[model samples]
Target: MIAVGRIFRIQQELDCVALYFDRFESFSSTQVTSQVGLSYDSRISRLQWTDFAEAIPKLCCKTLADIPLIDDSAYVRELLQHAVMDDLLGPANGPNELIKDMSVRDRYLVGKLAPRETLDEGNDWGNSAVDEAEDVVPDDLEVKAKPAPPTAGKRTKGGEQPKDDEALGKGEPETSDEIDVSKNQSLVPSSFGITFCVDGEAERIEVEARWGRYERIHDHGITKTRKNKNKKTGKEEEIEVKVWQRIPCGGKMVLDLKQGPVSRRSPD
Candidate 1:
């Protein structure tokens, strides 16, 4: 009975310590304050660590946007540290909700907790799935972007010019440098225009090639890439999708298609 009682008391003490630390963190940092009288009346802001304990509760449920106007107080820093630890521990009062509710600036500090190696190529190291796809990145490096179709300014109305609005407005205005060029293109029939293997397994698909810059006016539109294979010879070929051809992140793309029969090679 005594041992159980002692354990309860220790737990209570620990809880109290945590609470005190949470509250103390808010006032621990240096703050900017308005300076008093000069020979000529002028307002100057001086930095000091002031009454943080009193000021902290005001930010109890506030976001990073709600940080005191003066900014970067020791108390706030400590509070943020405690909040991060709490988040990692999945604690109830370590400001996890408040941190989540914070503005972009505060969220940046949280994001910093992630290691540099994990964020090397905008890779999300925080997720376990990315860690598993270690081999995908290498294969991605081999693929290159497909060349854009002739631009609108370059298009002249003559011999083999496009006959329709849809044909005339093929590729969109997105920067080609920003786009991901695909490897393995296929050309096929109207019903099944192309054929290519994502993981080496054949996908009988269709491709759409476009001329100049085209843009999608709204969301939820479908853009198709076509490819085809000779059934008898099994010689596979794919025509490029001229409008917007981008190879997705190899790791993420492969993971997304893991349930499918073919697993895509890692991309650069």
Candidate 2:
């Protein structure tokens, strides 16, 4: 019961939608009842497992009217009237625009979806962990250090950005009662705590990924040809070279367009 591609979930923590999944032992909750006993699990829409990382970017730009999952067009229009501006999902999203015919108060969502620090605190990772990984991480796979968090609050959507440890200092209440013990059981390093089956083994690679940031991450490996001493001929022979695909916490793993059928397998 492994979970796979393009799955959408309303990140109850940040109140934004997110695309989430990877191969791992299937873990699910039975209609999770919240503190007041209302179940929020049904807010998720699980598409069947398959790979389509390449097509996801376009989705971010589309409005609910453009990509209606439910048949109720009128309802979508209603949500749009009071919802966040178009392009909710995106690396390609444009500046936040106000929904038409709505007041300033009704134009955006009520709460912030993700924490301010998570967005403002760019991952300042170092390359020291590359060689230590099972796969040689490519230089391009590196995510740059994020600039400092915004100092002033803007009146745009998703509430205001955090003002340095304010959420923690104030002991802000958890947005929802959604709780999972599985996070504590993750074997991988970060909160992106899942592993995959490649070449018949669980690749327990450590990654420094941010939760709730949905985007395409292209994985690469060191697949270069280098000269090596041929003990028999004592000559450098041009040999075919293959390398592992790096798993950066930064992106999703669709079957690499560079790879083919059976190029890898999901955990069984």
Candidate 3:
């Protein structure tokens, strides 16, 4: 019965190949899956075997011996490994009779196959072996010298500028309007309560300006127009004018403390 179970499980593993191929051909087309009404996740689970098969081709396997099998069962892995080795060694002579005729019951009773151990021990041993091999270098070997520091006034290999001299070069003065325009260029204008004209239709928008403590509103010159009567003809005509006022400064006066005045001059 034990021998029979092993053979049955081996046959089931072989049958998985055909099942996987069918799924690969089915879900390979996006239009077909949509027409057949299958969700993407459901289709993915059905085609996992295909992924394993595709990985084998990338390994450039030339013979059955080159194929890799990652099976959970130790018995299944041993059976597959023996079958592949036999095929590569003697392709003309069919399957190895030794493996085919062996009884799983007799093997278990005689303890020919040891119990499987956890993979953690094997992995730790491999890491320790690598560390031991790397430590074998001679201690007397000379080590390479470290690189020298970069000199001043010389550019680095990456062409990065020095941080200490960023303001050494002359640059154009920046205005408040230019700075504000550049900061808002990347954002969507609609989010800022702004609108744009479309198809020759005008759009009305209102904007508020805010200033920090060191910032002030600049006053550009203003112009105004008014209608006036001509002095001689008594005819009204439009005249353009610009106007501004100046205030007297009280600080400009200087007092003469030592002078004594007794005469007053008449107005001339």
Q: Residue by residue across 34-143, what tens digits does model 3's lDDT show?
A: 34333256523443445434433333322223433434477556656655643443211222112122222221222111112223545221221112212212232223
Best by TM-score: 1
Which ranking of candidates, highest lDDT first?
2, 1, 3
lDDT of 2 by residue, 1-268 (tens): 2122322332222235443322112223332223213323465644322323322223243322333344456745654543343223321122222122222222222221221122124524322222222232223333344344444544336685554544324433334232221222232223223555555453334323322221222342223344677889887665533322222233334443333453533321
Backbone N/Cα/C clashes per model: 35, 3, 0
For candidate 3, the TM-score is 0.13
Evaluate all candidate structures by whole-model CA lDDT and list the values in order.
0.31, 0.32, 0.29
Query: In model 3, how many backbone clashes occur?
Result: 0
The regions of model 2 sitting more than 4 angstroms off are 1-188, 192-224, 244-268
Candidate 1 lDDT, 1-268, residue by residue in tens: 0000001111122124322222111432232222221122354333232443243333343333344343347955775665565444322232212222122222232211212323444744332212322211233334354444544544446756665544555444434232111111221111123455665564342333321111212233434433466677677644322222112121122234334575434333
- Candidate 1 local Cα displacement, residue 104, angstroms: 18
Q: Highest lDDT: which candidate? A: 2
Off by over 4 Å in 1: 1-17, 21-73, 84-150, 153-160, 163-169, 172-268
Query: How many angstroms is residue 237 displaced in model 1 relative to the true structure, after the best TM-score fit?
Result: 46
Which segments of model 3 are wrong by more than 4 Å?
1-32, 40-268
Error of 3 at 252 (Å): 98
